[model samples]
Target: MVKESKLLPRPEFQRRLVWSRDDKNHFLDSVLRGYPFPEIYFADGDVNLETGEGTQLLVDGLQRVSTLIQYFDGDDNLKLTSAPTYRALNEDEKKAFLQYDVAVRDLGGISKEEIIEVFKRLNATKYSLLDIEINNAVYAGALKTFCEQIAEKDFFRAHNIFNASDYKRMGDLRYVLSLVGTMVQGYFNRDDAFENLLDRYNDEFPMHAEISGRLQNIFDFIEECGFDPKTRAWKKADLFTLLIELDQVLHIRNERLQPSKVLEELTSFYDGVDSSGVNQGSVSSIYYKAALQASNDKINRVRRGAIIGGILLELSESEIREKLRVEGLA
Candidate 1:
């Protein structure tokens, strides 16, 4: 038979019963309504020989037990009122909890000197808990939260953009932020510029707000750029090129790209492309040269081609070609 002792909270535990009153009451109500709950695991404590009582404290599973006691005692306020009730009874109600049979395995036989070795071995096992490095590097806090918000919003549901499992993995907020940081490095002056950008958001900068608004516009514009859902491959170079061109058109400096004007310019560019067979391949090269006349460097010509193609697909080829010819791109 399992020995029953009142389990106390340990100081080293990361979390306490931090749930709000409503949250606690709702959880207790669900339990009182006969809703089944999963069994909780606890690490047993050592017994005090002089007192003949075990220093039983919780290692895990504090929340469920706390909820049960709160509701049973009619403490609707859901406060941590008193010590937990741990009775050694064979009653049906108790059986629902104790039937799992808590066995007290003696770790007392193991010397303190060998404890570290044992801990290392156990932790290195396949089912071991996640290390801090793995958690931080593979799954960062910001990326995780961002992904969760996206999933909760059902952003990809209509498009089936990402698989459910893929969404879960990508939800690591840190990784997503890192990728965005890499893309936006050109606009920031400092090495840790992304960190500063996050600080700006937290600080409520107006420019940051404008940039966020523009990002949403950009996402919408990409969809209009003939992104293939089945193949999952977009006209990558063209998308970047158009974004750069639109940035120039709007006179958006550094990272402060305005969404409203960017969208209007994108639509205008698309509406200007000609579709006549007289200038198919030449159309992309022509518009590209015209759009990039400010820099007009020969190195970026190949990249300009794809952007021109995207414009052709969206607009009339003749109009764009005529403008390019007038600008000396023909």
Candidate 2:
């Protein structure tokens, strides 16, 4: 339909194409991977009464359908970063890609004004969408794709870092984005810097290889430490803090950390926090409180990172306590 001009991808009233090459690459990747995307919507267009032929105005999914046409035509503009391009795929894969199903809705014989209303209504919503959802829409580029790849690594899978709700809402992407973002530019409160990071690295993430290496090292080091599944280090918030701090010590600070020492100290500190109870004067109690309350806030994140970093440095409990006390944190 697109090739024969029976279906129009963009009518004059439709928004201009704003997808980056990176965005197109990732979308193509999804299609090649057989991942389902949201449906497209179309409305009726002019009919050639004598010929019994009619056209359809693409009311929604302009980017997706346009990408598909470009990929099928083997357009050079649609480069493959992580997925095989159409010409590169084997015969069976090419057949599968060509046969991929796309869900679509057609609004039959609607007037232009009704088409406009339908488009607006399709996009309208009373509830606010999450930041991850907005980012997923606007910046389907390199950084986002990198995070998506990292989120699928065996380390995260084995540790069960993400829950079902996280997967359902792209929270896994956000989580890995947060990890990489914090590694590059230290902690900020609750995804505060995610959009900036996503936009800044959308075209090309130059640190992709370097960051991947560093993250793999961190994951391996964490695994070598061999903390039990019951350890708080496996919990989301604590795991986040541990990874951030360990990244600081091992990568940023260029300090060596012993796996056995890390395992022993972290286990003890996590257990201390777990058993600290209401003992407000203890460092473990303070760390425990911060981890439990508004944990994503800059102050609490800093508190958690400092304690964990110090532990990774093989600091004594008393020394860690004194440092926090001097900083008026404990």
Candidate 3:
């Protein structure tokens, strides 16, 4: 025969009430409307028994059970009443709830440890909770909120420039922030000091607001560079080389090292190569050599010719010959 047990809350189980407002409302509406729901399971133990008679402690489905009790007995407001309502339940109401026959199943005298293991497996399988999303949602303080905002607006658009598969593989928005941080650090005197100053400024003044703006401009420039913006197929190594050339050009041309100048130079380089009918496989190779020579103030005629020659080697002989004659490289 099936052993009959009373519905009770477990003392050891603290109710976390993790359900969102929408989730709670929908659950309550379903129950009140007599809509069928999946059977609520409970992991029975000494904790449930210790709470004594009349007051049934919930082992699982605390939010659902609590919602029902509150709606039926207390105020119908349903906004998870802040004041304690459980202790105020009268004798008749308490008896009615206790007598409420919920389908109860026993684990056939399973050990406490075994029961816990079963409970964990059941919850894990049922919810399909993502640990990272849960952690971010649960402790969603200031930084997490800021990160989420950046991701939704800036990161989402920027990442979509690549193919869908590549974007998903890149993981979260933090990686993009880290890359931007790396670039920002390159401009300052002391990297740590700059980071500290930025953090302090963000805390006091609203200077960090510019970060989102800067990121938008950066992505815009990347789009104009003729590389597939969505897949970011330009490659990180290529970007690094391009950044070096951009920095050099900005310094030499007495231009501000801002997003606009960066974009202009990047677009110009690609346009120049395309117009010249240069068949260099990777523009990065040319930019790398140019950056190296520019850094040493060795960008003279001879050095330029040598760099151009190296770039041409990557092209077919006929194409290189034609490009050489056109550019006076012959």
Candidate 4:
């Protein structure tokens, strides 16, 4: 169809091919390994009445089709890492490659406006996709990929930072994006700044090396603290606050935190929250409440940060007793 010009891969409304070389390679790998990909969509285009031949406008899957054409032609630009080139395959393998099944849908006799609407709906939110999931389609660039790599880090897996649902819905990516985004440009309410950060660094993430090292050190420090996994500190919300607080003290303030002190202090504070807030100071109680409410709001985030930051400070024996227990130490 491509050779005969009966299939128009890119209509005036189709998005330009945006898949990277790695993405193309991975797609080809799946094809070579005999894995099925999603179906393509097409709509009717201009028909030549005399010849009774009509072109079909490619409504979707432009990237996939383009990559396949490139592979068939052995285009110099289409490099394969794991998947063998089409020319390298023997007769039988080459026949299988040419005969690979691509499920396609034909939206026949649709108006241009309908085609446009279909394109819009195809790309835009459908099935209540999360903002992060939508962003995954829009931005396959550096910042987004960076967050994805961080989400897969062994540290998060070891600490069980993300649950199964998180992995399924890209919540893990969202969490890492929130953390990295906050580290670069202080706290913002929920994920308000994620799109801005993603757009700004789409082509290149300037702070990748520096931020990677900073986060690694922070993760190592947290591991050294040896806080019990069953404690509140390991809860998603509390862990986020703790990491942000540590980032401030260690990186922003250029001060070192005592691991033993952090473990002892945070464990006691979390324990107080678990024990019905009894004997805990007003500040600790406030932090606990903030964590329970709209914890992602900027106001609550700031409040939590202030309290956690204060906890990291070196205090006198009197201050310690006064801060942790308003009713006096037991």
Name the top lDDT candidate: 2
Task: Give me the runs in candidate 4 sitting further than 4 Å from their true place.
Answer: 1-127, 277-281, 315-330
lDDT tens digits by residue: candidate 1, 239-316? 445544444333343334444444454455444432223244566335444344432233343235334433433445
Predicted candidate 3 versus true structure: per-residue lDDT over 1-330, tens digit per residue:
011335554333232345555776687555434466666555444444566533333434556666666556655556643333434667865565455555544554455456444544555753433333223223334333444465566434554523443233222433333334434443222122323433433434342465555555545554554454532225343343343334333333334444444444445444554344223543433433433433223232223333333332234445544654565534
RMSD to true structure for each model, in Å: 14.0, 11.8, 15.5, 10.1
Clashing pairs in 3: 8-57, 9-56, 9-57, 9-58, 161-229, 161-230, 161-231, 162-230, 162-231
Order the candidates by TM-score, highest first — what do you get? 2, 4, 1, 3
Q: Rank the candidates by lDDT, best first.
A: 2, 4, 3, 1
Clashes of each: 14, 0, 9, 0
The residue-by-residue lDDT of candidate 2 on 1-330, one tens digit each, is: 988998999774454455677988888888999999989998889989999899998987888898898888888877767777788889999999988999999888887767666665665563234677656656768998899999999998898888876775677888899899988888898988988998999999999999999999999999999999999998888999998998899988999889998898889888989998755777788789889999888888888888888888878789988888787777
Q: Over all chains combined, what TM-score does candidate 4 have?
A: 0.62
TM-score for candidate 3: 0.30
- Judge candidate 4 at residue 184 and give its lDDT: 91
Clashes of 4: 0
TM-score of every model versus the real structure: 0.33, 0.65, 0.30, 0.62
